[model samples]
Target chain A: AAADDLAFHEFEEAANLLAETPDAATTSQSDKLTSQEHVAVVVGSGIGYGAEGEEEDDKTSLLQDEKPQPRFWTFDYYQSFFDVDTSQVLDRIKGSLLPHPGHNFVRHHLRNRPDLYGPFWICATLAFVLAVTGNLTLVLAQRRDPSIHYSPQFHKVTIAGITIYCYAWLVPLALWGFLRWRQGTRERMGLYTFLETVCVYGYSLFVFIPTVVLWLIPVQWLQWLFGALALALSAAGLVFTLWPVVREDTRLVAAALLSIVVLLHALLALGCKLYFFQPLPLDHVVPAPQAIPPSPNVLLPSSVQPMTTF
Target chain B: AEAEDSPGEQEATSSKPLFAGLSDVSISQDIPIEGEITIPSGTRAQECDSSTLNESIRRTIMRDLKAVGRKFMHVLYPRKSNTLLRDWDLWGPLILCVSLALMLQKSSVEGKRDGGSPEFAEVFVIIWFGAVTITLNSKLLGGNISFFQSLCVLGYCVLPLNIAMLICRLLLLAGQGPINFMIRLFVVLVMFAWSVIASTAFLADCQPPNRKALAVYPVFLFYFVVSWMILTFTP
Candidate 1:
């Protein structure tokens, strides 16, 4: 009878514990719901670090949309052209330097937002570099033999700047225009924006920086090797990156355009190396100082004659 | 000693009267002195007299010149980019650019049959143009920097190239020889690298991590061109 009474008490205790658990569970569940609400508020406020900044950027963009778009003639319109960050620029440059086998740099890297910043500067820098380095190689050659009469040619800078600018900008413009003109519904994939073409050309010249620097070494074989390597890399980069854009064109047109690109790049590389890095002609001596009449009497007559004629 | 002490004592007594006169004015005005008369305690005010105008002007000019010199020294041994960014000025750059252009410029009046060399304007334009374009490139690359600050650094970094130009000029005067040529080459190459390194040192912090190479390439090219001009500069 005692054992039965004990068993009954044990069952009552078990039932009491079971009854307390639901109350505890309900309170805990309510606490979780409240905590979740707090988390939602925090997220909503955008007080968090990484994702919040993105949210802020979105907000700014949305605000900008609310404002009227700037006209094309205004500075604000062009301001949008420089909207790339360092990582994006670097990625594009790297893509240009080393062309990936299967990647379309245009589609992958530059589709949404093509930038003018890299192309503009790259062409300018290349123009300056080619002119300066060309002059330097000539100077280096002159130093090896004092007998050779060499004057530092400054015209190269202007020439280089113009050439590079034209190639980087105008060629792209023409290519873009041509492709657009030829593009039809059937050949829609062949068209790339003018900026995209320029961007490719501009970034493609990056490999030449180190190559031109290497050209300073004065080794014939080494210089050629660098020039060839650079040309191949840059041309390959341009050709392959632009291949998909021209893919939908007829085989002949595509082939012709691609070959022209490769040819122009080669011509530029070869021209820079040959013209700028040419050795001093060992056969040519410093031209003897031209005979100017040392006599004041003779100089007076010549000077007076010019004045008289005028 | 007695004479000095007597005068000092007399001055002290006289200064007391000066304060006393101030207090008398306050008393006469009937402004109840709520607090002890606090003699407007400060260094005696200086008069803007004509006698010191020249001296003051000279002092200011000297100070500005000294600051420019300090900036030049800073470029030579660049420890921090902030030294440049803190007080960016175009003075050093202007001087360097002018001197470089003067050195590099081939005057058409010199009447050489070959007129292909760069004119003064060309060199000037290239230097300024290259710097402006490079700065624009950095700005476009989303670098957190200002235009003038970038220009100041780029311009100042031309110091090495200028020095190399000077050396090359001197070496050219020594007459052409293999040894002289080698020295010129070495100097030009070293200074070229120095210029690129120095500018990059100043510019590297402003660039984003991944695109440092992108930003630096232009600077490298800019200096390389200038150094090339320096190296190949024949009389």
Candidate 2:
């Protein structure tokens, strides 16, 4: 019933838009400069791209019923586990750089696709890097103390990949959901706009990308410092993209929400540092050298035979 | 092409920034976001074009050899634009299976002339069985893919593992040491990791998320076992 209502509303809106479109088009040529900006914004905010060439017919009865819906995003978008699309993955890497000060790349580029294809895939790949590098750090730590046992997560390839992929997807998703719910909208914003938030959130986490290789530094203090920097950058990138879009009346509410986002990044970076970028012997409770004395009885001469009993 | 050539200055002159008063930020209207630009432009996967399947198998080995080779290399990017997946067929898999069998034949029985070697038999049985088992698992687990499609994807995804095996065989000649052991271990681990990722990219298309993972797990284990074999291979 709601779907039918929505379709009806869409049709009615189209009719009204058609009626207005003629006048809009008549002025549109003169208004092209101003309207171009509006078109980009409309397209950027997830409304479909402005179709050209049929402006006059579209103003009449071109709105027959509905068009071939891309149904681009599944109801869940990237919320589905089975979802995977390489183009979506590539788009996201560009999406992460929404902070770049140039042609409004985010609004321009992201206008292309309506779906969040493989946020999990991007997260998982990064997690895979973190897993391997974390394992490498563990090896370095173990060299410092023979007794240090590595996390069992690295014991199997699939286990580590899935563990990293699943967790990476879950944490960001939870954060995105929290921010959206906090936005005070019950009827979710239009699909494209909603996914832009999701994409921006996923891409901002690319701040953690450096940690994949930086974990090899093997210095505890350096790793901690890098982790903090990554957290700040990731948090800042998100805030920048999200800042303009926050409802004009509720700027304070958005600010409050953003601080929490910063906190989430802190927690994420700390989690990565503790779980993934552990520095050798820095946080663990290692016994002092003096605790175990070199007992003469146990310390036999080089020629003495070793005990064979198990 | 015309739109892409539009002036960057126009975007600068016309568009207001996302935060208008804050800065002079602007976005070009002509920028093509990939999904919108690329996906529709791609050659679509043929839906059960069985009549051409046999002919494609021959062409895959004969005329389409270079294309198949390029697709094998695309395991790295796994881009949606790869025409191999778009024009999905049996030839890619047939070439892969045959070449892989030949590669394993050399590795499994490099020093032995024994015709009835168990390693040869094991490779033969396991490759087909692994492919069939995965197809059945996907079918039973509610995957909406055709049997041949699954077979084709499974075969292509093994390219990395095949490359890893070849690398291992070459590294085995460098004499044993901690460095050699570590390098081999790293390669195997990464290849194992890539196999899981690449396979899931093409093969993970079922519903009821948990079931998809269940179906994928066996493929993961199968690749893991293959990597393990490569890691342990010694002359």
Which candidate number would show the highest TM-score if scored against the true structure? 1
- Scanning candidate 2 chain A in windows of ten residues, the lowest lDDT window is A60-69
Native-referenced Cα lDDT, model 2: 0.53
- Cα lDDT tens digits, model 1, A220-274, are 6577677788888898888888788778878998899899878878777766665
Quote the lDDT for B229 in model 1: 69
For model 2, the stretches where C-alpha displacement exceeds 4 angstroms are A1-66, A70-92, A98-106, A142-192, A247-251, A279-310, B1-147, B156-176, B182-235
DockQ for every model comes to: 0.27, 0.02
The digit string of per-residue lDDT tens for model 2 on B52-72 reads 333456654555677676777
Every model: iRMSD: 10.0, 15.5
Q: lDDT tens digits, residues A1-310, model 2?
A: 9999986776555445434443232121123334434333323332342564343333222221222222546422222222323343455565564455333324544443333333433454465556556656756666656676433222323444565555455655665566566556634332225455556665666667776578687544465566666666666667666555543425677678778777766655555555454344323523232222221221113323121110
lDDT of 1: 0.69
